[model samples]
Target: MALLSYPRRHPSIHLLILSAYALFLLPILDGLELGGDGLYREILRDETVLRLKELGKVIAFSDEEGVRFQTTFLGSAAVAVQDVLKLNSLEGTANALGEVRYSPESVGSYVEVHIEQGPVLEALHYPLAAELVLTLETLCKEPNKFLTYDEECGCFTEESLAGLVCTVGELLTWPSASNVIPGQVNFTVDIRAMDDKVRETIVTSFSRLVLQRCDDRLVDCAVEQKHAAAATPCDAELTSRLERATRSTISSMAAGVRRAGGETPVLMSGAGHDAMAMARLTKVGMLFVRCRGGVSHSPEESVMDDDVWAAGLALVNFIDQNAVDAAAATAAESDVASGFARPHWSQAAHQFGCNRAP
Candidate 1:
């Protein structure tokens, strides 16, 4: 109840304060880091929001005369520290590292429309898939392991730890000379899985392996958890709506196009997105459009115009359907509350002498 209360006693604001914590509905309002795909993705989000607004209704109801509707969207303020450190010197960036002040509470549902960014949909011959979950992790080591003493060998051997590199990307060894024994090595690890348990197991094993190898060689090993994002799951009820929307709009595009029952699969996102951050606040879901060759973030990556249209239509349909269902349910509850319907247990109460005065 504390989470759902509106801040103001406005006449126009009718909040849905359910113990299930049904709150704001989120749509893909914007996209960040606009590579070529980013621009297209933003267009899709803007258009979907615009169409929903034109429907002349808001997802949440209000008792006030003129309440403005509000929906949550992902904000780009939570950029990685490693990325920010690259552009500007760390001198004036202390304030930037402070906690995020603007997270909304108890999100009802989230829907993001974007290019699939992977080859799964294309391989499956389906135009769309709901991204049910995401996985990500980060691993780190400090100081330097090369400086560690070897009692048996007695001499510094650089070739011994050559095969110990697990994460290959962005590895930097200290001392920028050909003749120097490398004293420090820093690298990053990124992984994704649909299941949180699976991701946890992988991270645990990886960390254990790194420490064991370092201990065996008598190297001082330190691991710093730079980032760890748990897998986010889509709400089943909303996911069902997405599936239906996809079938009605995307499946009906061409006649006799076999839209198999289980053909349009639900996928787990390997790449991280703002959805992962939003998951902390509320429920999240995603609609994926097929990407050509499953290629993304490259010049060769492409998406068909037809697929884009289908995605937009599906989004519009989902929003409309949700509004209608919500309004009907609200009206039904209002009627029951007004004493239009009799309780089935009323007769039983009377028989047991438990009936009270009206």
Candidate 2:
């Protein structure tokens, strides 16, 4: 829905599809009972699939977890789109939900633009980056061991947790009141890393250590995996193109500007995006714009006007470059098919200005 106005702005661009059903929002229930709840109703609708099948490439303005619908009420839980649809038997609702089925060739590639959502870009004073990576969320329950420290636990050691980032973003307790000791505690653990193997290893080690420590203390503990996603890397070719576009845009904006690392920065995103899911259907790439203090999902989250302009200009440059490359490739194929000698590598490079930076 974010790019719905793109077609109006750029008339040359064809077919900007909006998959509104992909929206994920907070769950709300009010005694509504419905049947037909399962995997059969969780897939993309036929209409959406047909629209996607028409595109050779997709350019998405991806936000974290699609568009988040927030609520002011405390203790409200987030729910998947499929679950929300199941509670209603409204007209056309059943037809819009189906079992999973998608062809890999429907779309050849995907590119997303998003916010950095972390402090790296702000700290370095850069406007944008080509990001790669994702996240896993888990719920851990223990009996009053929230503040307990165990020196012997390997999971608690710096050596075992190296290169891994873990955060307890949510917590819930029973008998929550002053002068009352909580009998049970539940907390959500979010773990992330650039490498899937390292992340998985850390998760396994940490869960095992938690269970063993709880057993030794004669208290009950359980680690339930609420959500998990393997690290998804951006396509190498697309990432290179995006980086070039970003560099070009920044240099053109300020000819004498100094870059923190003397080059366009590449970052690893610990947060998840819709691009991760799109990766299953086609190649994926991402561009991240700098946010104030690398903070997101909070009232303090902000982006500079110049950074926003840079991001938009970079995307335009990336798309234009892609079109040029595609046209060149098409011409070469046509020449070969018509029984004409193909252009030499050097000549082709010169014609496309491949030797020129960006």
Whole-model lDDT values for every prediction: 0.49, 0.50
* Stretches of model 1 off by over 4 angstroms after superposition: 1-37, 54-107, 137-167, 176-181, 259-263, 336-358
At residue 239, give the lDDT of candidate 1: 76
Best by TM-score: 2
Q: TM-scores for all candidates? A: 0.60, 0.62
* Best lDDT among the predictions, by candidate number: 2
How do the residues 1-358 of candidate 1 rate in per-residue lDDT, one tens digit apiece?
2222332321111112222223233322222222334345534534443333322222322211111211112132122112233232334455654442224443455565656767667776777877665543212211122223345977434543321223554578888578998898777675444445444655788889999999999998887765565666667777788888877665445532354555557765655554555565556677778878766545666887656666766665665566556556656667654322222222322332222111
All-Cα superposition RMSD per candidate: 16.2, 12.2
Taking all chains together, the TM-score of candidate 1 against the true structure is 0.60
For residues 121-175, could you state the per-residue lDDT of candidate 2 as single tens digits? 7777788888655443222211112222235663444443344568887799888
Candidate 1 has an lDDT of 0.49
Model 2 per-residue lDDT at 341: 26
At residue 143, what lDDT does model 1 achieve? Answer: 10
